[model samples]
Target: MALDEAALETLGLGTMWVRRGAPSGQGVVEDEPALEEPRAAAYETASPAARPAAVQSVEAKPVAREPESQSVSAAPTESAPGDTPVRPVPPETAKTIRIAPAPEPEPLDEPAWDDFEPVPPVGFDPAPASAPAARSADIAALDWEALEARVSNCERCRLCEKRTNTVFGVGDRAGDWMLIGEGPGENEDKQGEPFVGQAGKLLDSMLRALSLARGENVYIANVVKCRPPGNRNPEPDEVAQCEPYLQRQVALVKPKLIIALGRVAAQNLLKTDASISSLRGRVHRYEDVPVIVTYHPAYLLRSLPDKAKAWVDLCLAYDTYRQAIPNDKARS
Candidate 1:
């Protein structure tokens, strides 16, 4: 028995089929009537008793159709009673998703270098600097009165701080014998003169032994004009500061011979660190003047034996003086 169009459609076979004797390329059956619309309407309207026996027989024995290997286009379609509706899936496409970059960090506000100032460390206290000493050239150019004035007001070293007076010097300015001693002691500082203590008495006796006296042919001075505190030895810097004054005095006096009394005087005058004992026998020269080393009168007071040595040094000085000035008859 042959199945009609409505029965084939009901069984999901909606595609047209060619008859066995249909033309080869025409794809239509010859002499067949058009049955699509009329058959589909009849299937919908006809009752169970009114339907064709062949259609009813085909419905009772339905044929299953094989699934086609083709892509289906998504389209909306009506559903029959008791059927579930299917949703169409959309085709995949290449999409571009852009992510905003993180915001850049703001620059920090910094202080300028010009606004910074240096800070000194805690508990720091700076000492006041001492005044600069006078230049040698300036001191050399000064005359007697000018040099004395300068020495009176000099503050070139720390020794000036404790001095009661500056012992500039005493005796004849043109004396042929120049006696240089160490710094002043307590009595000399108070009297504003060099060797005015018990040391001064010993020095006077020595001077009389040679037929010389202060303010006569003997000019007296010292390595330093100011007295050291506690009668301690004058420091090297203190001696250096006062050296110009002594040099100027030597220049003005133009002494025939110089007597350096004690280790300090001998060392500084001869510019030697040799001990007084080693220096005693030698004839040293200072600014072209013969220098005789002797123990200081103050030293002689403490050391009585060395007094004899000092007399020998004085005798040597007198001999040297005679050689320098032969005609002058001071003493032997």
Candidate 2:
């Protein structure tokens, strides 16, 4: 027997409890209204659209038992005349279940402070800073000839006191490749070039390997134009004084790629004290231009095995330069 829709509403029940069922031969005890006036009014006034679909009520009467084959958890019941479907009393019921959430996990056992090494925060530089990365407005504004003349006679630092000739760099003023070295070596100071002597020869071979000649399509320069005493690395003041000249050179040449040779060259150009081992095989930026790092030709002359690694860095620079092209083409 299926109960009328109005009867289900009056009994504070929903369609989920009003499923069709086989007749219960046993007669219903009472058809008296189950809900009092207040309850019936609440159920009637609640909009049908707002009601839950799956609720039921049990009367104080025996529901027909499910077939023996049915599971105890899902026993089916029969309906009596003038009543909605009846169901068996639930064996176990939960009026409400309150579960406290699991507690926050305790932090794992930390080792003693001595067992761990300290890590500096990101961008934490311990090295003493050199002078401001000062740019010479004068240098920035000078044309090629004026800039070259200024570098040749530059006496701005102690290096100028001892250098034989100021190596004013050589190559295409408007080319797309620039080479920066640390400072002038003995051969460089004498010959007025960035890379010369045996190192210069090795550099020439390396450039030919990439099909770029020294002054043909590449501009070669040093961090400081003058040689440091005894070919020592350029001092902080020397590099600081000369940075503007190099910056101007970069601004003028507008190279697609800048290859920094060795540790001193890499660190000074990048404004860091990091070693070449960490800097190599990676592309850094000089402002917006791409800079690649490699072993100095002088270092390669002594450590022949590193020549292979230098070759790889050059290849990376070549590939990067090709990518900078408007259409992925690089000048030879």
TM-scores, in order shown? Answer: 0.59, 0.58
Question: Residues 1-332, candidate 1, lDDT per residue (tens digit)?
Answer: 13565466577454443333322222222212454445555666677666675344323232232233323432334455665543332223326679999999998898878668776589765443322333677888999999999999999899989889999999999998899999899998998998996889889999999999988988999999999999998888899889999999999998989999889999988888989989987788999889999998888899898878888888898888888786445444
Question: Each prediction's Cα lDDT score?
Answer: 0.78, 0.77
lDDT (10s digit) by residue, model 2, range 201-228 = 9999999999989889899998888989
- Count backbone clashes in candidate 2: 0
Clashing pairs in 2: none
Worst 10 residues of 2 by lDDT: 52-61
- Misplaced by over 4 Å in model 1 are 1-134, 326-332
lDDT of 1: 0.78
Give model 1's clash tally.
0
